[model samples]
Target: MSMQDTLDTASRKLLERAAPGRVDFENLVVVPLFAVVAALILGALTMLATSVEPATIGRSYLALLQGSVGSLAAISETLTAAAPLILAGLGLALGFRAGLFNIGAEGQILMGGMAAVICGFSFSHLPFAVLMPLCVISGGAAGAFYASIAGWLRAATGAHEVITTIMLNMISYRLVDYMLRLPWVQRPGRADPISQSVPPNAELPALLQWLDPNLRLHAGIFLTLLAVVVVYWLLFRTKLGFEFRASGASPEAARYAGMRASLIIVLAMATAGMLAGLAGANQVLGVLGRASPGFSAGIGFDAIAVALLGRSHPVGVLFAGLLFGALEAGGRQMQVDAGVSIDLIGIIQALIIVFIAAPLLVRALFPWGFRRPDSGDGRS
Candidate 1:
């Protein structure tokens, strides 16, 4: 071949290899952020429709900020909220990366919480050294086992995870309803569905010791951050991460390369479930001090939103969890201080997800509403 031809061929190979990753990264960053920005706009419009005063949004938001961080107690509560969200969001992101949607996190949380409570209450005379690890493992195992069913179905039969996970979620609610009230699981002589509190030594320590005792923030937030770093490392810096992404994007291509697609699906769900279980364990051992119905507070579902908002990246999920935690902590204040319906929070969340997933719809509609589609509303 001619020297010029050889040089051109080499340059083209390098260019192809270099360009896609950079362009892909840009898409990853912008799409999710744009979704969030659009959601806020839609949320603001919703508030205006409700006839809320202009300053009310500002006042409520400030109050929320004060509650979330201005004081020790608020900060504690904010961290507590973020703890479960981080774990749950990580779980969802993992599943997404493996082309599975483990929507059954709520159920997994239930089982994990139940497992932790059982370990905490049943075990006697154990030192804190053993007790903590025991609780963590048992909880994660419970969630892993719960999620495995959906994974098994997907592996065995081409079952769509979306359907299986949702079905399992329903089944989990019923199972929890039955188990929390069991003679062994329930609080003695009480009709309430709460379980006995975790042992004091078994509880996680609050990391911000400088904060006043009035604060409720525990060590769980640090752990959640740790999980984020680990997930990022796993997803981007490791061979397993590569396999997970490849399997997710194209199963056939993965099979062509001799990757074990089914095994990856099972292992991926197991990993995701383990994180979710840890969230359940955190609620019991750190924040709630016991198992309670609705302890997760739909954080599992919210994690999906967080994963989407964060573009399923670990760093994105952490920030997304914190943002949602802040919104949740502030939302009550928004309602009480501004008389805005708490329902508005739900509306805002839905709008954010909708707008983020479909920004083109907003851009196009607004313009016609801006240029082409505004055809006199089909009127004369």
Candidate 2:
């Protein structure tokens, strides 16, 4: 064929190739949103199937909104829940960026809270000036160390992080339970597993106490924002960040490019663990003010949904966390107001993941409502 004719064929092929990736991208973005909408619709259907009216779900949904964000006190409670979610989800999201799935946020959180409690109760003489930072740092460090074990295993052996991290989560629960049962940690003569209240100095400053004691929003929200910024910087700016991302994208390619893949893996896990631990610490400092049995209430698991729903973007994760927090905090009112099943939230979460994971299905269904990505390479 003539060179000109060959070029024409190549260009046509390139255009065809480009169409799919572009369609896929649009599909990805639109599918998840549609999935959420579909999930809610499914939930309504479920309500009807269970002998509850579809209006029961919507009625409770509205009440849940009112209880979570309606008044000043409600808004504060929402923020309070959002704070820890922001921290924990960011941690999990970072791990995802580095191709590491550090699923031990629960344990990391427990250790962080336990460490914060230890610092708070022990440093009774320290002024709020010193005590708060001390609690924060100690909590983060405790979580980091706890996560390092899984990192070490991944680096040294071919062990998958999902397994080790999950195992560690269980261990952390038992360890924290044992520690809280100690006479020094537990309140004297208290039959409960709860620790003593953190010193008032260790408590985070509430943002709007003037509104009401029920307005439990605290300065930890600021800390969560700081964490998001810092994670964003580390992922895109510094050389170390580049190494972490490179390893995550392709470990072999990173090694070929002379990057330390193993080290990056360990650091990524450590960083993720630290964030999760800080979340736990926030629980203690901002809301709980003490560690107890089942303190996290499965926030770690909920954080996974937050990360996936946000596509692992820092800003996206923050908003997703808040949304989940709203759903969680509002669930109580949903149950109370409309007598709807609390399981509806989980139903929605599952549906969102399903749509996100298989976006093609969504695009097939929402033909006019979505889009896809593009790739321009051509060689047939």
lDDT of each structure? 0.79, 0.81
- For model 2 the local lDDT of residue 220 reads 93
**Which digits, one per residue and each the tens of the lDDT, describe model 2 over residues 96-136?**
98898878888888888889888998897899999998999
Candidate 1 lDDT, tens digit per residue, 339-379? 77888778777876786567566555444322232222222
Q: In candidate 1, what residue range of length 10 has the lowest lDDT sum?
A: 371-380
TM-score of each: 0.86, 0.90
Model 1, position 33: C-alpha lDDT score? 57
TM-score of 1: 0.86
Q: Candidate 1, which segments miss by more than 4 Å at Cα?
A: 1-31, 69-72, 208-210, 359-380
Highest lDDT model number: 2
